[model samples]
Target: MYCDVTKEQDIGSLVQSTIRLHGRLGIMFCNAGVLSQSMKTILEFDLSSYEKFFAVNVGEVAASIEYAGQAMVKANSRGSIICKASIAAGLASDRNTDYVMSKSLVVALMRCASSQLAPHVIHVKIISPGPVATSALCATLGMGADDIESMFLRMFRLKNDGVLKVKHVADAAVFLATNSANSPMSNKLEGKVAIVTGGASGIGEATARHFAVHGIRMMVIADIQDELGQKVMESIGSHKCSYKHCDVADEEQVKNLVHSTVQNHGRLDIMFSNAGIVSNTTQTILELDFAEFDRIFAVNARGMGACVKHAARAMVELKIRGSIVCTASTSASSGSERFTDYCVSKHALVGLVNRQANSLGCMGLGLKGVTLDTKHIADAVLFLASQDSDLITGHDLVVDAGFLVR
Candidate 1:
């Protein structure tokens, strides 16, 4: 589709033309983006540079999506519309403050739009990529191909020589637009919703009880242990908490749990994927059993990933910037020895935070804490869910009593 995402006249006309030409709109790619003059950091860049950056990068995208969404609704097509975002907001770089800030704003915009547009059966999504090998990017960096390739490999976890192409972006957009995907509506988080991934005990149980007292309306208490999970929910009272058997290690059940939580609660807002198992003894990688190592990684690393992925998907469908608190540990920073399994996974949890934080931050979402007290973490999440930490995103305040600092 011919789209000029910035100009009101152009956007209006593009939507009008789409209806005239195709009679129906299946998807909208709100993909027009730009960057600003590169600089060392936030301090080096002036306010005017940022203003220009946001104008071209963020304001234009929001305006375009707003215009396109109205057209899609008028055509009566439940379509998936994806926007382009960047991972720079999460990862620190040597320069380009304006670009990073602008990208961060896009994520917040997508999130807010996700909430506003979902009622019309329109899905708002964001495709965030790390560094890509685009000629435009190399030109922007003003560096040779070899130097750029080396830098990218050193900086990013997923490093490829290929410049991030427009097609790579297009492919991601296509996936979100597929009609066969039965994504839960983004508006499902507007009202009260209950969630308890590891609600049977520890931090999960504590968070559950805190939310319960504050008025959660409906809840689904999920845990691997049937009796404990059920009993915890029952203790919380049937009117507020209901138990579900979930082992986040199983990807299939993770999907089922999220769907079931949204179904049971009629809405979902708070998700605490706080379930994790730590090895009692500290063993080096060579000393630990493959089985034992796998067990901890299963529940702590991949398990948390599954829970966040599904919960985030549901939250996006509901058009809500829900609070997600993964149970990372003090060991994440200190590098505990015998606890190699725990340390590795907890460290990786921070990586997950950085990735999604950039996307969500642009959408006015905030992530808080790394290893605070259970009650403190609960309060922090609840505080973030409120208006307190609106500007705080992509941050993990380590509550290890200065262990990491030392």
Candidate 2:
């Protein structure tokens, strides 16, 4: 039977009808959502457009959950409610604030419903997709079929593989639905929550995927690259991770990222402040531009500082012995030509880690500060995040293949 989920009566009737026909309600996938065609920024947003987007994206999903959850409770049966969300939920999109906000609200609803319905053994999971070659996506972006292929390649920087297919998302949803209660593998990081900054590509993305593989209950992958971040989320499976667009240079955005993680996941156990940017143009000390220096410090040093501050506060407030890991380069100890500002920014991380370690240690928080490859750094982070490194704090684990020594 077809039903309009936005209509309360339709949702109620659909649930009742399903139960009457099947004798029980086992699984409900609230997957219907809409994206507005108007590419408007926040300042140019129209309230009516925003409402329309939310009505289908957020309102319908919540209504389905309520109606479906009630049916599950009445029947005394275990069930899973999987909501379709987007990687956009976590990231900011240009000229698509309405779509982004609506999807973000969907994620919030899933978290809220998960907690409220846990007593009834109803599992609530959000499947957030990156970019799939769907008709809706093509239509919204006003791209032709050929343009879509090239766009994905350029957006994700894909070589030949790693393009997100619709089947990948379907597989993820099936996994979540089937294993809603218990996972097959014995995950080391099970029941823990984490936040990974710069998680769109390279080291940050690798670390997020590693955390998910280790069985982290939830991960907030924060990055400014929406498409790349979504790709990472898709690869990791949204059952374990979600992407958020965050520019670490912005302190308010960093604070919001941490606050939202804790709000959605209940507590934060690990924070990987791995976002950093280097100066593109090389300049000697005499020729260095103050603006260039400031830009590097903004993200590499100050951004990491903001992340540590908020992560520490959340850990302390919740009485969690959390681990805070920052990315420090070998340049922190050694110097390199044409990278004076980059080296300086990394050195600042070393100092920040040392001081934060001592300060947070007094409050029972762990701070350790990686880079062979992205995976090697991710492994070091995993160790620090796990019980193996519980006694280790205020230390920097450098993974640069002997570059510093050489």
Candidate 3:
């Protein structure tokens, strides 16, 4: 249980013991790492410290992945392998050169590992958190969590002071473990521009407002409801957000929307494809309306694909490695008595996201659903690990008590 990752034998024994106990490894989370106490800049970088840092950060992580991945492959057990990376490395910083370089290498290592292990159906994912008030970070800075968070707000000039939390990081890990998806999150949302489809109301509107609070420089609300979308944009501040009329079901409109945003903003960083609608009818197999089904798919499935395709093209063409998020329902994970059209379209959306993630390393989160409380999530995971959900993989069962609907 208590093993130094720096030791290969320790890692090997740990994996062996884990398999012995659990019969198979379901998840391997390589989260252990040491931060740079010296906070050395590139000018003052030292090789001796770099070696020590590399041993733990890069080397240890590689070892853990190898041991865990091998065990999973040998057992034919498909599982999730997650690693913790930092934004200080990703975004670049003036300090912590050794830490930064080590994390960068870790990213490269996991990327190769992701490709290599994909054949085995193993999900290798990275979570690049901006600044978490971890106990280690607090102790390193000799500051408390509140003080650290305050410092981050002032230092990063963050609009949302509550940007990073331990629970937030833990929640991301849970999603990756359950659904094989994660996001590259940063504390600073400043200077970022986004486009949110269906931003007129509901979850889309709420997320748009939150993005504004978190310091998005500009965001375009694309929706068919011109009046409501304009109202939400005005409420969030027109200087930061603007409303545009674009039906995602229309490929030309989606294409124009993405290209116009990039042309106007100079760069598009986040694409939140949240446009979708449920059928008025029950939509079960027996009474399924092909017309209604096509309508829903046009918006939710084909429309989402168009958004992702154009957004990715704009990002790649401009050489901007941006993030795209698709709003999918938990219903995608399972079948129900009704809303089959809505559920199938969501499944298509999920498939699109997962495909892009594998091929392009897209910044997407698998938020199938979770309850308002942590205990409910733990119970869900427990059931997932049990025989009840043995057939499930890449599934995010919504444990929310009808909150997603209500």
TM-score, every prediction: 0.52, 0.54, 0.51
lDDT of 2 by residue, 1-406 (tens): 8887678899899999989998998899998877778878988989987777788889899899999999999999889999999888877778688888888888888878887887787888877777777778778788875688677767653312235566666755665576422345547588999999998988888778778878899999999899999998988889889999899999999999999999998999999999999788788787788899999999999999999999999998998888898998887887778778888889999998877676676676778885342246766677677755554567777655334433
By lDDT, is 1 or 3 better? 3
By summed lDDT, which 10 consecutive residues of candidate 1 come out lowest?
180-189
- Weakest 10 consecutive residues, lDDT, candidate 2? 156-165
lDDT-based ranking: 2, 3, 1
> What is candidate 3's CA lDDT for residue 329?
63
Off by over 4 Å in 2: 1-186, 371-375
Highest lDDT model number: 2
Per-residue CA lDDT of model 1 for 179-274, tens digit only, reads 311333222223467566788987678777767765577778888888888888889899877888888889899899889878766656767777
What lDDT does the true structure give each of the candidates? 0.69, 0.81, 0.74
What's every prediction's RMSD, in angstroms?
Answer: 16.3, 19.6, 15.5
For residues 1-406, could you state the per-residue lDDT of candidate 3 as single tens digits?
A: 8999888899999999988997899899999999997977888878987898888999888998999999999999878899998866566677888888889988888878887887787878877776779999999999999998888767653211234678767766776687321223323457877888898997678777767765678999999999999899889988999999999999999999998998899998777777888887886898889999999999989998898888878877776645566666667765579998988888877776655553443222221222121223433432332222222223334444333332
Ranking by TM-score: 2, 1, 3
Each candidate: how many clashes? 17, 3, 0
Q: What TM-score should be assigned to candidate 1?
A: 0.52
Q: Could you tell me how far off, in angstroms, the CA of residue 206 lies in candidate 1 after the best superposition?
A: 1.1
